[model samples]
Target chain A: MLTDSDSRNISIRAFRIDGRDNVATLLDPAAPGDRLKLLGDTELSAAPASPAGNEPCPEETPAPVLAALEPIPAGHKIALRDIESGEDIIKYGVVIGRAAAPIRRGHLVHIPLIRSLYDERSGHLDPETGKPKDISYE
Target chain B: MNNKTLSWPAYPRKDGRKGIRNILLIVYTVKCAEFVARKIAASFDCPDVQVTGFDGCTDNQYAVNLLISLIRHPNVGAVLTVGLGCEYVQAKWLSDIAAAEDKPSKSICIQDAGGTGASVREGISWCRGTLEFLSSAQTVPMTFSELVVGAECGGSDYTSGLAGNVVAGRFFDRLVDAGGTAIFEEIVEAIGLKSLLVQRAATPAAAAQLADVYDKMLDYCRSVGQYSISPGNFAGGLSTIEEKSMGAVIKSGSRPIQGVIKVSQKPPGKGLWLLDSTPDPHPVQFGITNPNDSEGLTALTSAGAHIVFLVTGRGSVVGSAVAPCIKITGNSSTFGRMSEDIDFNASEVLDGTCSMAQLTDRLVNVVIETASGKLTKAEKLGHFESWVPYKYQDTGSAGTRRCEGTE
Candidate 1:
């Protein structure tokens, strides 16, 4: 069984790769206590882990919490951190895109979903503050 | 420590070259004479007796030389030439060339051989006898190092660079390290990447040869009144010719190019070499040569490839006549859609589940297994196709030169 070392309530939903990867992509917007299976049919347990100082709210948080802890839908990517507008988006350990706005952990990352999420866009977004909402490239 | 011994079979040719396949070839000298050759081959009713095309006038040394080299290719057990009798490309020369190489060959000039009726009968006789000899041939054990691999990229996408082609490059590196040959062609698609490739030349002479190969392609592309990338490449999302070439060049890997060879020329040793493939755009005259990766692949295979490793991103279904093509795909979507067509999926690298080296190792094993008689998807589907050679522009003043370096 695989488990993340934080909140016990939320679990990993599904893993797209092996445990050796620095990051395992969420298959269905993972929660604090969901079971995840890696390739080759290996299974593991995972729980939600928080930033060093951030604590869980007294109220129960929804799975894949976004900006102000919003819930992102399936096939959507969430920010792993509070990404500032114009910062490079790294996926698969490569620079895939730059943030169009300040995005908080669990905030949704969606595009046309044609070729790649990062294929069309390039360059950094203008510097801004607060949990990033819909910021368009000018 | 001892290395594990491996086994392979060798079919020796009359010219002393070792082959991996015994083929009875019906070669069409011109487009006007294609139907005659095909009909004769079909009547012969042997899959191994296949039709290969080349339309060269007798005056064209390059075309004639290429034709002679192919007719006597190691894989070919025998040859039959077909022509209209009045064409500048003489059938008698082909017959003589094959006979000189000790191959059983016959030429049927439609006019002199008493037109279609007599020509078909005579050509059919040659095809039957050639097939018989080919069937009776024995196989001898050949080594891994003896195999030649052709690297071709068609129906490409961005993943081609990030996954399929790059992984193929790694495989080329390993093959070179192990003293095996890798051939990379479609020089038109390889232009902008030549600067990077010059670093991989094994010697100063080879480096100069590499430069010549680049210049010839650029010159041809310019002279041809068109750019190398077609509408297909543009639709595939390639912005510029250089961008497309950058992806194509990765298939050669990081191996030092030992020499530059023509379409008919084989590599001298176990190293990478760029094949000069800047051909005419007309498929009718040139017979589906340039912009047709399948034909370029077939040319490479006929040159003596035991297995052809095709890397695609957007996806292609074409295969070769002379060798088993192992298709490696880069896009997860493409692989998923055409899993039956693709042999290996390096797209696993994109998801970060597997490293490039890991995929390369797996691919090399695939090549080894394929060379040992594992039929590829195309082979099972009977997708054997032929291609035409690219014709380069002649510089009235700037002629051909010889290599000044040592062996």
Candidate 2:
């Protein structure tokens, strides 16, 4: 999962999909020139002219990054950002669905709905140490 | 194992097989004659009998294989296949398979009966007789080793590898220790672990057979131009096929891979196994087609499993027709999202709330109870989704040949 420092680790503009994705979609409306910070540390210069191949973000502009990405098609999951179709989808840092479609820099991905029965998270804190509680809900 | 005693009311069978329920089944040869199949089952209460779907094709070998396996399931006391007469799959073939097991079966075609109405009436009469025969069956005391348990993890997340699978693995180890059979399938996930698996073989021949099964699966996946690392596993935080495999393979517990089996073959002895599910990989958008966990469970049941221990991370609303699928959930969030579908939640292992041994013991008791006749979430909800075999375009032209130069 590690890479060389010379390789700039960019933040997903709303999300940068792969480290090597050609372009990133804009979550917020940006003027011709906007200074953006990268996620991982490798320095790179943004093109003066917005890179070509910018499609309209799935959602309206002026929204926060992750929020701005719109839902993709049903049963077809999209790349979180720009990613190759063969690459895995990393949500909550786990595999839920595979990338069924190629993602643009900012195109939203949709997760197929499988009927799940449980959704509760542990909130029990250890009374003695005040640490998060470990408990079996059912 | 001593802390608790699992119990349930089971139907004792003539072959010494134990069943949680006795069901008269109305099977169909094709989608075309589904109406006749339903009419046969509709004459009785749902509890007494139910209709299960399986389309028999003229040339789909896998479909024929599945139908034959399903018809002989211990849960099915008697069966009747409704054929449309002109279809490729013959009623006689199906009946012969069922009859070979000494199970009562009949086939009626709409064309032979003069029409759908007459066929339905004939089917209903046959089913009624089957139901009467099933009702006379009794419960027999079957030993633990008489059961062949199948393990599967789907809708997986991190906990799937960490806990859900581990729990199943523990059960698998215990099942083997107790002299029962256990099967772990979806061979694509067993990649990279072959060395470790081969090490578990009881004999050299078994080890070589295990390696061959892995080779076939590896070859099949490479030929289809499909990556063995499912996009779902990658999205779920698994990095490589190996990482996904490490998690997926844990479901077999630490039992030896006794003998490799094909989708249609039953496990011949007690121990671990890898079933070849490498028929064909469906495209990512649609996900690969697999037998409903229940259908696979039924195959294991026909192979002689009395019950199944199912584990899930993503969670599914699923149940089996013959063996009860006692689902254990692994993902903390998903366990919360689908509590109803889950019978046991091992998500605590992720948070360190519960030790692995503690969860394993809990799961073992659940299996015992399920075998004794407890209804699983899927069984209760009536989720009977089964899949047909995957079909390739050319049915094995040179295009489907295994690649030469890849691992």
Candidate 3:
């Protein structure tokens, strides 16, 4: 049973679709130092401490919380754990892309930082506009 | 599971099909007749009068079959076919098919009618009289069991999988449970999930069919060196085609897929169906499949969908010709920005203000309202965008006969 205060703190700011997922999706625009509560895959709620205070945690956690490392837009991915460079970025329990550089826990996971395995052009896109930088029809 | 009683007033057709709209469809046989057809439709200034047709002068069996299906669509009360006299796809042949279906139809050739002006004048006259005649057509009560709904997603973002498609999936489950039919297309979008798709087949035969379609689509993508993904999908936080596929397939719900039906082929005793618009395997691949969102919607409309759902996480402003498209977006901001074009906002589920079931119930209410003569935003705004591209697909024994040229 959750206390009223604990229940009040249970805001779903991000969602993890599968248990093996290394990334979660942000439901709202998040800024640095903002703590986001995770939803979905309740089995993974008991993993461990999420890179914060070292005090002994409660046995039954309301929801796992993570701190944002940067300004991430809504509907974007956030790393649930520290992902090494060239490692697979897992979401929906499947490999969506490979990390181009070492990504810290709670850091934003997106294009240029991550490259698609099938399409090499995924990494060669303009960061601001998300369009291919080298292609021209004319 | 709510067991809500769903029913609507429908324009009953001679073939025992029920329609939510009584439209006077204008068919242009070739590009030459397009201007006259548009003028005739615009002269009425009524949403019920709409234009759709093939632009090719050359013979393509696929295009002819698609046109025939549109003419026989239950929503179209009457049809008027316009041609440029020399086109292989004769307007008279199309009008004859419509007449055979017990619909009042007419055909006018631009060359035979003396010019574009004469053709437009005659088409407008026929439309005016047909609209008046269809106004008095009796409507009967239609139940949920009689409904066939199709779903397609476009301009997808991360919220599409988490919220938009999830709500649609839950609604599809409910609709299927209530004994209604549901269809979802874009097999090319279901990349890296062949086994999952095959596992959801309702029958062993359907499972085999799904496996074959999946393999063919994968090969087609490889041969063309292009998956169905786009830069907008990447901008929207989708990393790869696999991630997008995982999200796109959720709109099919958990219902066992009945079987794979070709484009323009109606579902054979449907609960849930997968429409394969991909070209048949050939030594040489020709046209692109589902080049745009409107093409996908038009394919679904040709498959006898009484109502179609267009789920857009980023937002879209398109509707189909025969079926009223209900646009839905899961991104609340996108919905806010495009509220006039988007119909339902599934972001309530993401905001924790409502559960998925609650959102699905609300979506069901929207569907029922749209089916009960409520004009969708697209219909109100007159956004009946349709596309009929020349594509090659094996038109199996699905009742669409090969065109043997106009008599």
lDDT by residue for model 3 over A7-123, one digit each (tens)?
356453887765667888988778897778777634322322121123323232223457788998777888988889999776655556789999999899887888866666767
Alpha carbon lDDT of each predicted model: 0.61, 0.57, 0.82
Q: Rank the candidates by lDDT, best first.
A: 3, 1, 2
Please give, for residues B1-407, the per-residue lDDT of candidate 3 as tens digits. 35546577899888888999999999999998999999999988778999999998996877888999999999999999999999899999999999999999999999999997888889888888999999999999988888889999998888888888877877888889988899998888887666677777789888878877877777677768788888777776777777788788879887888988887888889599999888776665555766889999999999999888999987899988999999989889999999999999998877767877788889999988988999999999998888888887887832122222111
Error of 2 at B189 (Å): 0.7
Worst window of 10 by summed lDDT in candidate 2 chain B: B392-401
List per-candidate RMSD values in Å: 10.6, 15.1, 6.9
Candidate 2 deviant stretches above 4 angstroms = A1-138, B1-18, B42-48, B280-302, B390-406
Clashing pairs in 3: none
> What is the iRMS for every candidate structure?
15.1, 18.0, 7.8
Better of 1 and 2 by lDDT: 1
Q: Write the per-residue lDDT of candidate 2 for residues B64-122, one digit (tens) a residue.
A: 76667667777767778788877788777888777777778887878889887899888
Model 1 chain A: ten consecutive residues of lowest lDDT: A43-52
